[model samples]
Each structure stands twice: as structure tokens, then as C-alpha cells.
Target chain A: MMRIEDILMTLRMFQDENCDVRTVTLGINLMDCADSDLATTCRKLQEKIRRLAGDLVQEGTLVAEEYGIPIVNFRLAITPVAWWAADYGVDGLVRVARALDQVAQEVGVDFVGGFSARVEKGATRADNALIAAIPEALASTERVCGSVNVASTRAGINMDALLAVSRSILDLARRTADTDGFGCAKLVVFANMPDDNPFMAGAVHGGGEPECVINVGVSGPGVVKRAVERLRAGSPDLNLGDLAEEIKCTAYRVTRIGELIGTALAQRLRVPFGIVDLSLAPTPRIGDSVGEILQMMGIGRVGAAGSTAALALLTDAVKKGGAFASSSVGGLSGAFIPVSEDAVLAEAAARGDLPVDKLEAMTSICSVGLDMVCIPGDTSAETLAGVMADECAIGVMNHKTTACRLIPVPGKGPGERAVFGGLFGEAPVQPVRSGGEDFIRFGGRIPAPIHGLRN
Target chain B: MSDNSQDFIIAVMAKDRPGIIAAITQTVFELGGNVTELSQTVMGGYFTLILRATLPAERKESVIKQHLEEDWPDLALAACVRRYSPERLFEPELDTAAYFLTIQGEDRPGLIALITRYLAERQINIEDLYTRTEGDAITLILQIHPQNRQSAEHLRADLQNFGERQGIAIHLLHRDILRATSEVGAIRRMVRQGGCLS
Candidate 1:
């Protein structure tokens, strides 16, 4: 029997602190939906996604109600479409994107991922076609999300693919200039992307995954923050190591809740249960910012001198706790610092306390890199490519997952705000240093680092 | 005491002291009793215990009570003994799911009666409840098991309405969430057993 004190503590965490499962994504492999004809493939793809994911939202609601924990989003991730649409042209890929968007709406999923291609080593002709069509496909669709992997530890960095994606992101921003370049928010560029991540716009049903599986993403920055505050108040002489211990214990509890709910939902759906991503993903809601956790750790501001070290400690402690709580921990199981999505981070960005360089530096120790960051409109494609290259280098050298979801709000400059609303939140455009055109134009693969030759 | 071969259920109460358990169990052992199960707790300066044992079938309940009173007269021990039947050994399967409902408000008359009446009308069984009053504030923590699969949304709305009418705050949550957050070993056992039903 559990002690009454334990029960009351958990209740306080839920009622006062913001602790809840972030997302439950169903990854459905759609490689078999391919066909020689474009129309047949589109029809078959929609039918298959609708058939597989029809009950996903309803089932998620049932489980959330049963557990009394709010599941914020129900999403779907499919096998990379570029692989299936290899023979098809750019027009054919757009049609497929439209079909996916339609099916996502029909099934009531918030986002459909895997409109992507993996070109870390080299780009196939089909991958090139999909990259060409990204701007239009994203602007036309409401729920389809796209991601491209351009680097990895084994393959080094594909600078050509990186340059192309940078240009595509520019075009995407230009196309959605009305919504402050919101189209770019739906696309992510990655290095060593996880195939089973349940969060978007980067989640995908990798070729290695089963036909269908349920992956859960758990979040609770507020719970950690509260625990830290309580510890500080209770023991005025507590040190950083003691604070980290409290975070680890709190993360252990949060991850276990995710595992329990994910397993129960999977059992009910009769699909194999996949990983539980223990990332401390924050929402725009007040009191749920990962940056606030850094502040609580005594960093006065998020981008102060000791911010990176603080984030490293936090990320490592979270992983340690989550790894112990669940054997099936995978995906980006660390702290996420998406600027616009976290209220405190966004405020710091606006206040000039957190700059793009400091954020990039923090990425080396965190989960996702440069996530939900907004830059000035006139920032050139070369500069964008340079930013992506720098982030990807960290991932390759460290052999960890890193991604960029940069939005260049067209015609907007630094000190201006771009509001994307909802979970995408809003952010003030941060200034970027220029003069990287020559290096970005020198487009070729950055060969694998010395660490990549371990095998 | 009943026949030496019979099983007996016994309850013992006395002023809480370190040697109470030793003396009580010694008395039972001397009566040719084999202890099966035992539970003891100290509350408000008094120790209480319940135990099940098998003893000589010829031993009568009155004889065991008399022996406990005579042996622990200084401590003023009270004991109850009765024959145990097979039906007394049966325990119900814990198939029903559990939930935790907490209510907080200013202390008032009939608060517990009013809320319990609502649950009783809905066929929700209260497994355990604890209430505490500090100054003018009262907090009630209740563990419940619904007789059937009830829609949680409906229950929440009903509770919300009740809270509004009574001017109190109510929170209800599944017991598994609490267990997962508070007890790592319990969650491990639950996962290893392939379900959160327990």
C-alpha cells in the first residue's frame, strides 16, 4: 500500500504544479501505400492513414479521462514520404502532402509528420524534388509537417543538402509572409533525428519502426520548478548538487506517469508500445518555462555567464532520472529550450538577455537546437545555412540529436514581435550577425569528425 | 478457548508499551496457538492488535480472555477471541479501480455528511478517508472505488456543481497517477505485472 503522504504529494503536484503528458503520437509506417500511379498512391495513402489513425484521438481522450491527466495533443508520424515518392515529381509530392493534410483533419490529429527525406550522406533525385516542393506544400497544407536530415555522426554533414534546405526555408517564409512566416514553423531541419520521437514537426516513423506503435512525450517543467523552490525554501543552505537531486527525483516521478499512461493506451489500442520521451518540453503557459528552471537554479537570467553549465546539469539530471524510471526511454530525452514555446525564454529573448549565439551554445548540452527561434526578414539564406551548419556540427561531434526550427518573419526586423499564437507561441525577432555568405556558398560535405571513426 | 484444533481470531488492546506485543504473543503461544496473521498499531497512547491463530480445538474464547486479563492486570489489557471460519479467511479480489478525491474549505457543520451522501447516492464506495482541521480550515482526503465504469467527466461536473453550491474546492484524480508519481517501487511492480489495475 502507498503511504497517504505520497498520495497527497502527487495530488499537490497535479493540482498546483503543471504536470501532464504532452503528447501521444501514433507512428504508422506508410511505405506500403506507394504505387506506380500518383492518384492511386494518394488515394491509398489517405485511406490507410485514416483507417489506422481513425480511433487515435478518441482513444487518447478515453485514456486521458481515465487517468485524469490531460493529454495535450494527439499526432501521427508516418514513414518518410520522399522514399515512397522517389519516382514521383515535385507535383506528385505536393499531391501526397495535400492528401496527408486531408487525412489528418479527418482523423483529428494536430499534426502529421514524415513529409521528409533523409539526405545526410547524399540527396537522391526524389529527395531533391521533395525539397523543391517544400515551400508550396507547406504553405498549402494546414497540418502536414516536414523535416530533412542533413547530417549525422557517421556521414558527417551534407553541406549541399544544408544549403538547399536553407533556401527552401527562405522560400517558405516568403510564401507565408502574411502570418509572419508561419510556414517555416511547420518545418524542421535535423542532424541524427530520432525515428520514434512523438513530438513534431520532427517526429517520423523511421524505416526501422514497426507497422504501428504508440510513442509518448512527457513534460513537466513546472513540477521541477516548484520542487526546486520548495527545496530552497525548506533548506536555505542547500547547494546546486542538492537542487539537481530534487530535479532528478521529480523527473523520475514524471517519467513513470508517462510510461504508465502510454502503456495503458497502447494496450487499449492493441498497438505495440514504443518509447517514452522524457523531454521537459515547456508550453507558453506561465510557470511552465524551462528557462525559469535555470533562473531558479540561481542564474539571474537565462543567457548569463553560467547559463550553459546550468542547462547541462539540468539536461543530464533529467536523462539520468528518466533512464532509471523507464527501460524504454528514447527520442530526445532531455531538456528542450524552444524560445517562443517557453514564456520565460521568450521574455529573455525580447529583453536581449538571451541572444541567438547563447542559445546555440546552450544547444550543445540540451535536446533540440535553436528551436522556435525567429530572425530578421532580410537575413540571407547563406546566414541561415551557416546557423544550421553550426548546430549540426555540435550534434555530429557530440553524437547527439540536434535540430533547427527557425522562422524568418518576412519584412520584420529585430525588436519586432511575431505572434504565431497557440502552442507555437510568439517571439521577438533576435538579431543575427551577417558576413557568412562566402562560407555558406562554399557548399560541399563537411567530412565526418575524428570521433565518427570509432567504429 | 475452543478445541485445540480450531482456528481463532483475536483482538488485543492496552496502554501502549514496548513489551505489550511480547507478553500478548507469549500468552497465545502458551495456549498452543499457531499465529497466522497479525497487525498492530499505536494510536492516542493506546496499542491495538488483531491476529488470527490456530489453537487447540477445546480452548474456549472465555478461557483465553480470562488468561490475558489475569496475566496483564497491571497493564489493564483487553482481549477478544472468537472461532475463525473459512469464510473469514476469504478476501475480495481488488478488481475495482481506485481514485483519490480531496476537498478543502472552511470548517462547517455537516460537511462530511453532505459529501459522503453524494458519493453514496452515486454508488461510489469509500475505501478510506482522513480528515484534519487546522484553525478554521478543514481538509478531507478520500479514497474511493466506483461500482461500475463511470464516466469521469460526469463525475467531475457533478462534483464541481456540488463544490460551487457548498462553497468548497474539490479535486478528484485516478489513484494510478498518484502511485506513479509517489512510489517508484510500486510502479515497477505494477508494470512488471503487466497492468496498472492494482
Candidate 2:
């Protein structure tokens, strides 16, 4: 006869292993539904997303209950509609965006990523038109998220695309400044963008993926933190290698549960299951932070001397363990160091311990680049362009994916902080490097470098 | 960036010095080879250099390798040169998983031996490693690519028992590295469709 405490302990142990379903992303492939005719495309998109994702919220909740894990959010990733939306002009863009909003509301998904364009080397007529319409589309749509990939490792930096995106991101921020740069929040500019990332305003269905695939994102920052704490409790003799192994073991269990849940969800949804994205994606909550994990790693704080090595270890262990657990573990599967969403990181930024330069350094060893980074409202578009250029350069040169979603909060200057509540947490407005008059001025097209054509 | 191309991996090992890069670079330059990609790190008094140098159609790997050895013989060097076969570039079925497998214990002598033995049995490949001792504890972060079908849980379980016997705590996290995000895919598609995939 087991005591109630023992039962609770077992339950807690399981929860500690992989407690939460990080994300249940319903990928709605809209390519088939898209029409060259603006109104028809909008109508089909609206109808298709609403119908496909309509059961998302309820199904997600039920699945979480069944698995004894909490499903934190139900989201959607649609095909990038910018190319298709160009036919009807800005108004057509507006209509399609509004329709997406309705679909999101009806389906009860929190966010829908991939209202985007890819202009790394250059833009298409459709992509150009979509770029022009981004500000309006983002402003009007309540749930639609937009992303533009303007740089690659081999391609160097696409100055023409970066300059245009800089202005557009500024325009979006300015238009929606009152709403916590809400429009800006909807936009992300990326390098080496992934195709089946389940996280949004960055998620999109890659052409290589199945028609419909359920991708799972697993989150267990607190669990990993707890393991670190326990290891450090009675014994002080443990070294970094031992600590890293503990993290790897913890991540392995977490990833196993995620694979089980994702596979189950895909089976039930009748969709082909995609990879279980093992990204240590965080939220604003205190315990659920990648920074806290770094702190647990005895770095005192993130962005310190041992931060990169620690992250590299943590991230690599996560991949090894996750790869063994699931056959199709794809997407951004490393430990994500998103400063804004992780409370500890945000606090570090707020307190000035973690600077932009440090964050840039951290991204080299970790997955993703400067994400949800907040800059002063008065930050020059040129400086933002430079930041984008630097980050994209890392992506293109390294042959990895990196992105930036800079929110120059209007009237919010440096050292000021804003709390956007929920997942889009508060962030101290980091100051941009001054004096980009030269690089910004020399903004003619930076020709594609000779190395980008690796495929 | 033409499709009619080849890849060669040139690994340079030598004593830590400043001009080693310059000398190697000059050799590539004189040989009409372009240094396309390179990463170098100095550790424990040795400089390790890895480069993916692109050679024009006329110059082959043998010529490039010969130039380095014949010209810079005095620079105590061991070179491992291999041409990049086409298959290595795009084997989609290749396991793309990258993770940091960490092992910690009470500074036991056989901790690494035990962990690596298990990993070896499962055919897991370690990409990078950083290990050190803090007081009496030993920690290692092994960036690994586990073979297909072997679960991280199996390693975690094996390590757990190993740690118990060795009086240490072991942890594992699935660090999924190199898995392209959805955004990268969209960019590739959009670029291809836009006639910019090249």
C-alpha cells in the first residue's frame, strides 16, 4: 500500500521530468487554398484556418488533461501569404489579414505566424507588394504574425532588403506603439529561417514537410533548474561536466514525454507528425527561464565568461537526448536565449548586466539570435538596420538561423522599461549603437557573396 | 557560387602562433585558392585550424596540400586533407540532431570512460566537449549527435545508475541543434520561387 505522499511524489516526479506541453501548433498549409484573386484567397484562407484550427483549443486542453501535462498554448502556423496577398494590393492584404483575425478568434488560437515574405537576395513583385503592405496588415490583424528572412550565411547581407525592412519594422512600431509595439511584436526578420518551427510569430510550414504535420515544442526550464539545484545541494564537489550530464538526462526525459505527446496528438489529429522541436523556449514566468538555467549553471548570471560554453553544453546535450528519443526532432531544438520572454534574462537586461553585445555573443553558441529585443523608440532606422545586418551576417556566414524583432517603442527612450504583460514580457529599452551614418549611407545593394549557393 | 564546384577540408595542427594563419592564407592565395570558410581555436598550447577552401577548376587538392607542406616545412604541422564529396553536402536522411550530453560525478576516475563507453555502444557522435573540475566534482558537456533509434532516456538511465554507483548525479537535456526552423524553410522556398535560390 503506497501512501498518498508517495503517489503525489510519483506524479510530481513525472511532472518534473517534462511537465508542460510547450506548444500545440496547428500548421494550416494555405498553399492549396490560396487564390490569385485577392478576395477569394482571403475567403478561402479565412474559412480553411477557421475550420482546421477550430477544434484546436478544446482538443489541446483535452489532450493535456489526458496526458497529465498542461498544454500551455494552442497556436497556428500558416503558409506565408504575402506572395499570394500581393495580387489584391494593400486593401486585399487588409481583407486577408482581417479574415485571418476572424479565423484565429473562431479557432481560438492565440497567434498565427507566417504572414511573411522572403527577400534574402531580392524581392519578387509579389514579395515587394507584400512588404509594402506589412504595416497595414500587421496593424489590422489581431492574431496574424509576420516574418521576413532578409539574410543568409552564404549570401552575406541583403542591404536593399534590410533597409526596406528596417523602415517597415519602424513603421509597424510607430503605428502600434500605444499597444506595446504590438504590431512590431507581430514582425520578425530572420536569417537562415527554418521551415517547420512551431513557435510564432516565426513559425511556418516548410515545403519539405508533409501537407499537415503536428509539431510539438517542449518546455522545462524549471525542471532543469530544479535538477541543477538538487545536484548542488549537499555536494559542492561536482564539476561542470557532471552538471552538464545531469541537464542532459533531465532534457532527455522531457524530450521523451514531448515526443510521446506530439506523436499522440498527430495520430489523433490525423495529420503527419513533424519533429518535436526541443527548443528551451521560455515565457515571462520566473521559473520558466533559460537565464535561470544559466544562473543554475553557476554563471552568477547569463552573458558571463562561461555562458557560451554552458549554453553550448546545455544545447548540445538537449539535441543528443532529444534525437535519441524521437526520430523526427526538428525545428529550433536548442536552448533558446530569448531575453524578453525569459523573466530572468529580462531582469538582467533591465538591470544592465546582460547587454546587447553579450546577447550577440551568446547567440553564436545557442539557437536563434537577438529575439524580442526592445530598443529605444527614437532608435534610428539605420542603427536597427546595422543590428539586423550584424545578426544576419552571423546567420549567413555560419549557415544557421537567426532573427530579430526590434520594437522601438515610440516615446520610450533608453533606460526606460515597458511591461507588455503575458508572454510578451517587460523589457528595458536597450540603447542602439550610435553613428551609423556611414554604413547606413553606403546602403547600396551588397552583392550576394560567392558562398551562399550551397544547396 | 556556381554549382560546378568541389569542397575540401584542410585541417592544420601546429604550435600556437600568430603568423600561422597568415602563412597558410598566403599559400592558398598563391595557389589561386579562395578561403571560403574557416574556424580556428587555440587550446592547451596547440593551434587547431579547420578550413573549407575552394579551389578553381585547374587547382586540385593535391596541389594545395603539396604547396603547404613543400613551402612551409619548418612549421611543425600535421595536415588532414579530404575533398568534400557531393554526398556529404545533402544527405537529408542524416541525423541532424545536436545536443549537449553532460556528465557529472564525484571526480571519479572512470566517469568519462563509463559515459563514452555507453555512448560508443549506441553509436552517438560527440561534436564538441568542454570538461573541467570544480573543487572535487567533474562536469563534462559533450555536444553529441546520437544515432537513430537510441533514446536520450537510455543514456540518462545508464548514467543515473552509473552516477549512483560512482556517487554522483547525472543530467541530460535534448539540445536539438542544426534542425532548421520553419522560417529558414520559408526563406529557401520563397527565394527559389523568386529565382534567387542560387
Candidate 3:
């Protein structure tokens, strides 16, 4: 029999702290489904995805109930659509996206990702067409998500491609303006993107993966926050080192839960088990905020002086603990502070305590960059590209996976709230001191840094 | 670590004091035997121990009981001995997942009776249990095993009803998760090995 105290700790984690398996993404490679005809390609892609993912939701539900751990979302990722649809135009790609969305709904998955393009070097016809289709494809389908990778450590930042993507972000946000530009929330721009990230809107079954795989994302920001609070209460002389150890141990336990559920689901589905993305993806719920953990770690205000150091300590300790817990740890295994998704972070943004500059600084140490941050409606595409360029530079120079998911709520300005509702939450349109029109217009490529020539 | 054919199971109950184990082992040593396995518990100042021992030669149950009574004159003890058989093993846990059911409520008459009856109605077996009361705070920890998944599901619904009607705060969790958190090597058993308690 297990110790009763240990049993209660795990119980409290599940019961009050909202610890859960954030997502179980079923990645199905769709390279073989491609055909010369667009209709035939979409039909083949839908058939393959449906056949592979038909049991995904049902099996995931069964496993969750069996273990008493809630699996928040059952999602699907496929090979990047631009890889095989080189000749398909924007309309054809939109049709393909609708097919993916339909099959995802048929299988009862919450979202389908990889309506995406990779243009770290330059954009092909297919890549440009996919970017053009993203605004319509995402606005028409409720469950489809899109992503574009415009930078890498080795290939540097593709400024021209990012400019096109900046325009697409505006178009997508404008299409869903009534919902606080929610369509843009489902699209991400990444540098050094992971192939097996289970988190949307960046998940992709990129090259060099199996035919079918299962990657799990586990999150428990609330659990770690409660733990830190308990340690502070229990010790009069507790230091930052002690607090970090507490977070590490808590992360190890939660990551173990993720690996357990993911491996079992993969075995039942008879697919290869991929990796567990131990990113602390928080919800809009109060207690489940990464900002709460940072506050409990002694940062009085989220965007205050010590924000980046606190975030650096958090992400590094989490990676260390999760890496020890599971040998198959991959993807963006760091702490996430997505504004609006985390209640405290959103509140800080609304109060003007968390400015975009401070957020950008924090992202240099955290998981993703400028996540779920809403900007003014009239922010130009050039400025949007500028925002993405600065964030992508951090990623390329640091050799980390960084991304930006900026939502420009049409007709909303600074100090006005834009509500996306549900898990997307609501936040004020953070003011952007926009400039750089000339510099952004002169778009070419930012050459790779000297350190990037590791090969 | 010797497994002999002539194995006997013994039970001893006495007052809470030291030297109880030494006396029992001393008597068993006189019979030229080795103690194989044992479980011991103490409740309300009384101690109970059950052990299995292997002997080179088979001995009567009466002989061991009488020898312990005459050998330790100052200690009053009640003892029972019987032949040990592998086929007669009594496994309290069912062939399904084990769960931890925790209960916290006010101290009242018939509370244990009510809880045990609840478990009995659902056909759940308690593999281990302990209760503590300190300054009006009572904590009851129960390790229960249901016969199958359907009964486990029923127990969950019943548990919610019991908690609500009885004004209690209760939580139920799988035992494997506790092991996964506490034991470093146990997660492999739960994941790669399916459901084994290593």
C-alpha cells in the first residue's frame, strides 16, 4: 500500500490544483496522401486522417477516466500541408483545410493543426499560397489551426516571408473581429519550431517522424504555485534555491503523470509513442496561472524588475525536473506565460504593469514569445512584422524555440477590452508604440549569426 | 531464505511492551525453525502479530502454544498456530485497480459502521486502513479494491452521495498515481509494464 500522505498530495494536485494532461495530440503523417489533383489529395488526406484518428477521442476518454486524470483536449497534427501541395493554389489549400476540419469534427477532436508553411529560407509558390489561404481557412473552420515558421538558427530570419505573414495575421484577425479577432489566436509565427509540439496553434507533424505518433502536453502551474506557497508557510528561512527545488520536484511528479497517460494511450492505439511536452500551459482559471507561480516566487509585479530572472529560473528548473522524469521529453519543454490565457498575466497587462517590451524580455527566457497578446486594430502590417522580427531574433540568436501569436482586435484600441471568451479569455488591447516603417519596408533577410554556423 | 515443506502459521497477541518479538523468536528458535513472513499491528495498547515459520520437522499447534505459555511466565499472551498452506492464501485485494479513499468528518457514533456498510454494499474490499483523531480532527485513510471497473464506477457515484448526505469531505484517487509520485522506479511499472505495483 502507498503512503497516505503521498496519496493525499496527489489527490490535492488533481482535486484543487487543476493538474491535468493539457493535450494528447495524435500526429498523422499525410505525405502519402498527396496527389496531382487537389480534390483527390484532399479526399485521400481526409480518409487517412479519419482512419487513423477515429478512435483517438474515445480511447483518450477511456484512459482519462481510468487514471482519474482529466485529458483536456484531444487534438490532431499532420504533416505541414505546403510540403506536398506545391502546385495547389490558395483556393485549393483552403479546400484542403476544410477537409481536415471536417474530419477532425467527425472524429470529435478539439482542434486540427498543420495548415501551415515553413519558409525559414524563402517562400515557394505553395508556401505563399498556404499563407494566403490561412485567413479564409481558419475563419471558415472552427477547429483548424495554422502556423508559419519564418526564422531558424541556421537559416536566419526571412523578413520578406514574415511581411507576408504579418499581412495574413491582420486579415485573419479582421475576419474574426466579432470574436475579438480569435482567428489570429489560432495562428502562430515561430522560429526554430519543434516538429512534435502538442500545443496549438503551433503543433505540426513535421519531417523526420513516424507514420503515426502520440505526443502529450502536461501542465500544472497551479500545483507548483500551491507548492511554493506551502513551502513559504512551512519555512521561516526558505531561500530561492529551496523554492526552485520544490518546483523541480513538483514538475517531476506531474511529468510522470503525463508520460504514464501518453504511453498507455499510444500502446492502446498501437502507434509509436513520441514525446511529452512538459510546458506549463495555463488556462484562464485563477489558480492555474504561471504568473501566480512567479508571484509566489517573490516577483511583486509580473513585469517588474526581476521578471526575466524569475522566468529563467522557472523554465530551467522545470526542464531539469521533467527531463529526469521522462527520457522521451521533447518539444518546447518550458514554462509558458501566455497573456490572457493566464489570469494574472492578463490582469497585469490590463493594468499596464506588463508592457509588450517587458513581455518580450521575459519571453527570451520562457517557452513561447508574445503569446496571446492583443494589439490595437490599426497596428500596421509593417509594425506587426517588426514585432515578430524582434522576437524571432531572440530565438535565432539563443537557439531556442520561440513563437509569436499576436491578435489585432479590429476596432479595439489601448485601454479597451477584447474578449475572446472561453480558453482564449479577454484582455485589453495592449498599446504598441509603433514605428520602424522604413526599416521594416526594406525587407530582405537577417543573415545567420556567427555562432549559428555550428555545422 | 529457506523454503521448507513443514511450515506453520502462528498468531500472538499481548500487551504493548518491548521484548515481545524477542520472546516469540526465541521460542521459534528452540523449535529449530526460521520465521519466513510476518505482519504486526497494535491498537489501544494491545499488540497482535501473525507470522509464518518453516521447521525441519512438523510440530503440533498445541505444543508451540503451550511452550510459549510456560516459557514466558511474566508476560500474559494469547496464541494460535496452524499448518501453513500456499493454496489457502487469503488475498484481500480483488483482481482490479486499487484506489485510495480518504474521509474527513466529525466524530460521531456509527460512522465506521456506516462507512463499512457503504463499502459492503458496493462489494469493495479494504486492503488496508488506518484512522487517527487529534484534537477533534479525524483522518481516515482507506485503501480499497473493487472487483472490477463497473463496480469501481458505481463506488464513485456512491461515494459522492455518501459525502454529500453525511456532510463529509472525501477524495478518491487511484493507488498507482500515488506510487508514480512517491517511488522513482514505480512509474515504469505503471507505464511500460501496464499496471503493476513494483
Which has the higher lDDT value, candidate number 2 or candidate number 3?
A: 3
- Greater-DockQ candidate between 1 and 3: 1
RMSD of 2: 19.8
lDDT accuracy of residue B78 in candidate 2:
66
Here, model 3's chain A TM-score works out at 0.99
Return the clash pairs for model 3, or none. Answer: none
TM-score of each: 0.94, 0.67, 0.95
Q: What is the fnat value (0 to 1) for candidate 1? A: 0.57
In model 1, what lDDT does residue A364 have? 97
* Candidate DockQ scores, in order: 0.51, 0.01, 0.49
lDDT of 2 by residue, A1-455 (tens): 11222222224434344457778887878888777676778778877776677776776665554334577778888778765555776667767777888788788888888778887777877777677778888887788888888876655567777888888888888888887676887888999888888887788875676666788888788778877888899579999888878777767766766665666566556676677787888888767788988898887967668887888888888888677656778888888777778899988888888888888877876778888888888777788899888888777777788888788888888788866778888888898787865786686556555676667
For candidate 1, give the lDDT of residue A401: 94
Report model 3's TM-score to 2 decimal places.
0.95
Candidate 2 yields a Cα-based lDDT of 0.73
Best by DockQ: 1
Give the poorly placed runs of model 3, Cα more than 4 Å off.
B1-4, B42-46, B88-95, B186-188, B195-198
| Candidate 1 lDDT, B1-198, residue by residue in tens | 544388889999998988888888899899988888998877779999999988898889999989887887787899998998777332223454678888989999999999999887777778778787889999888987666555344676588888999999888878777767776664545644634332
lDDT of 3 by residue, A51-100 (tens): 89999999998788777899999999999999988788988898998999
